[model samples]
Target: MRRHTDERAHVLVLHGGQQHSTEPTSWRQLSVLRSRLFAAAVARAGRQDRIGVSFLRYAQRGWNDGAPLRDATWALARVREEHPGIPVGLLGYSMGGRTALHLAGEVDALVTAAAWVEQADLPAVHPPTSGRALLLHGTEDQMTSPEGTLRAAERLREQGAEVDVRTDLADTHGMMRHRADWHRLAGAHLVQTLRTSTCDAGGRGAD
Candidate 1:
């Protein structure tokens, strides 16, 4: 893992998973591979800036009633341990997005990509007290509920979150249809939210 010990800001990237499964995760999985690629793109896009990124791959494949959340908690703690009080961001997809929801309150900014949000999940979200959030989803996403994502965004907004929700027309849960757009939205969110344009890099990556 690379280290940007002087990083001014940080981003933790998380991949998606199923709602109910205990299967171990691997780099070969589509969701994990996609997020790894996405994290690299974010790092490259923010190359001129000072940002540290860590991509967290959960030990198991499913949400499994908060198993991924536990992993994310540890990852965030790791980031805090590494960077201390520097601004932090959370970027997650699907089930990982669900995990991010539980931890968003701890970061400076958050981006949920094609997240699998349910009405019941909103209560667990304690909006970033001094931060904000962005929710991205596809209109045609069959695997996750775009409406639910929007609803979650609304709830976040009502709770005083500076929320912005965008939709990809005719896209799906895979995020491959409009890959660059996802990159643009998610990457821009990190750079803008973290304000790392002038910050340093070679930040540690979560392996």
Candidate 2:
């Protein structure tokens, strides 16, 4: 993949499984939701024009099934290669959230919703204490229980990582689309998380 303009700090968005082919889709299935969330957060954080967002398309059969953790590392490596000095962040929803977790340490910060992290898939080495992570989930997420996020938070805390979690009070699965109210709440939370990390010694914004 070729590196694009370096005018803005980059965010690589990942989509959940909707097909099994290794081919690209005509339109990203989750672009709207991704853009809305990214836009809201960037605006709130006062970094609207300083940020760039792009999608990470991958091959998969279903949300839960994909190449093992080792294989998925290539994608993260590519992102790092594209922006050698720029800070990278990930915003993933649903199954895409799971992919973010596996690749968390590779980025400066991560914002995930309704994700699950299998122990075996975790990075061999945890991200340094400087790395930051945020997890959000719906209390009524029938597809992936709030427990999934809770469990991930627990593990991260145990490892002395900076991880924060927030759960929507009444939203169900696909909370990102439930209503404008949910979006507002989530958007605010995400903006704060990313903003806080931006000033950390290791959280330098892209140049």
Candidate 3:
């Protein structure tokens, strides 16, 4: 078996997007810029250079027919191929969160911020069978419903994964109202998950 030589942990970052469209995404998109902030903040919160951050630039701007999922799969394959058995995590916002949640079974850890979840989004809630998940949702999100995120969390628990759901009161869909807390919680979760589930990230181990 190939061993994990690098001590650094890898995180694949995914940004938010639209719905039912076919436009290609770009770095100039505000959605990508927001996710870029997430990546940078998470990296800084982590063990400095020990955390490898790669923000995925998707081919399209929407989740049309699971295009984002495909792009994420491709990106993950690259990460695994180059880094082999290193601890890998997924961090996403909104539509990107939806995409990461869809592929939770394949990574060591995952963080979903302001995840876009509707009734239709439940079918893709594949929690990490051998890892952990952190769901961060704002209590006052105007775009994605926090109730929907709660429902998704319920499914994640039912599937028998170690899941942590945190609510940021007064924050909105953009997750900027308490930006420092959001970054601290999410970045801490990802790095701590990479370390160990029983660590000080305030998460429990798998049952």
Candidate 4:
């Protein structure tokens, strides 16, 4: 695992899919992608000083029967070891989103794009969160239907979470990377909601 400091909130970006897409080479590529996206998003967010990003690489695993949760568990353990004082936020794309939700307890906030949902893991409402959960899905996503994210949102809300679900009909699964407007919109909303949630928690703690 490698760490990179930036300006917003300390983030742990988990990458989706294998390196070669066909070869599933351990989690080296996943870690690399995680770091890359973290750097890019932090730069775009213009909160480089407030955020620090890190990546956790693991052994190779298959998509259908992958050890994503196991890898995530290990990754969070490492995060705890290195930066116990920092609140962790997760940004995962596609398969990485699935892993993020599966390991949601470890993060203060979750920003998932084009997440693949499994019925077994589906919460009657959105997944419970101590902080917040943001689901970003493309209305025109051909790979994973927007319905999946909508359902997840429903479950998360039911679970007593402050949830936000946004749809970008014009953006494809990977389109958020190319579309600055979409990225800014999504990122801003996420930052605002996270701060709100954190402030609320602090207020309660003070009381």
RMSDs, each prediction? 5.1, 4.9, 5.2, 4.2
lDDT of 1 by residue, 1-207 (tens): 224757777789999888888899999999998888778877876666668888998999988888998899999999999888678888888887888888888888798888888888888887764456888998888899898888888878878888878885568888888888888888887788777322322243322
On residues 138-161, what C-alpha lDDT tens digit does candidate 2 reach at each position? 787777778777777776677788
lDDT of 3 by residue, 1-207 (tens): 112235467788999999876888888888798889899887776655376788898988988878999999999999988876567889989999889888887887889999887788787787764457889998888888888778888888888877889875689888887888889988998887876632323244222
Error of 3 at 45 (Å): 2.0
Model 2 clash tally? Answer: 0
Full-model lDDT for every candidate = 0.81, 0.58, 0.81, 0.61
lDDT of 4 at 25: 45
**What overall lDDT, based on C-alpha atoms, would model 4 receive against the true structure?**
0.61
Residue-pair clash count for candidate 1: 3
lDDT of 4 by residue, 1-207 (tens): 234452234556666664223355453454445435544664456353354556544455335565766787787777767665445667767766777777776567777777776666674223435546888777777776678778777777766777878775577766554456545654664466545545665677789
Could you give the candidate ranking by TM-score, starting with the highest?
A: 1, 3, 4, 2
What C-alpha lDDT does candidate 1 achieve relative to the native structure? 0.81
Q: After superposition, how far is residue 139 of candidate 1 from its true place, in Å?
A: 1.4
Which regions of candidate 3 deviate over 4 angstroms?
Answer: 1-7, 197-207
Task: Give model 2's TM-score versus the native structure.
Answer: 0.70
lDDT measured at residue 186 in model 3 versus the true structure, 0 to 100: 88
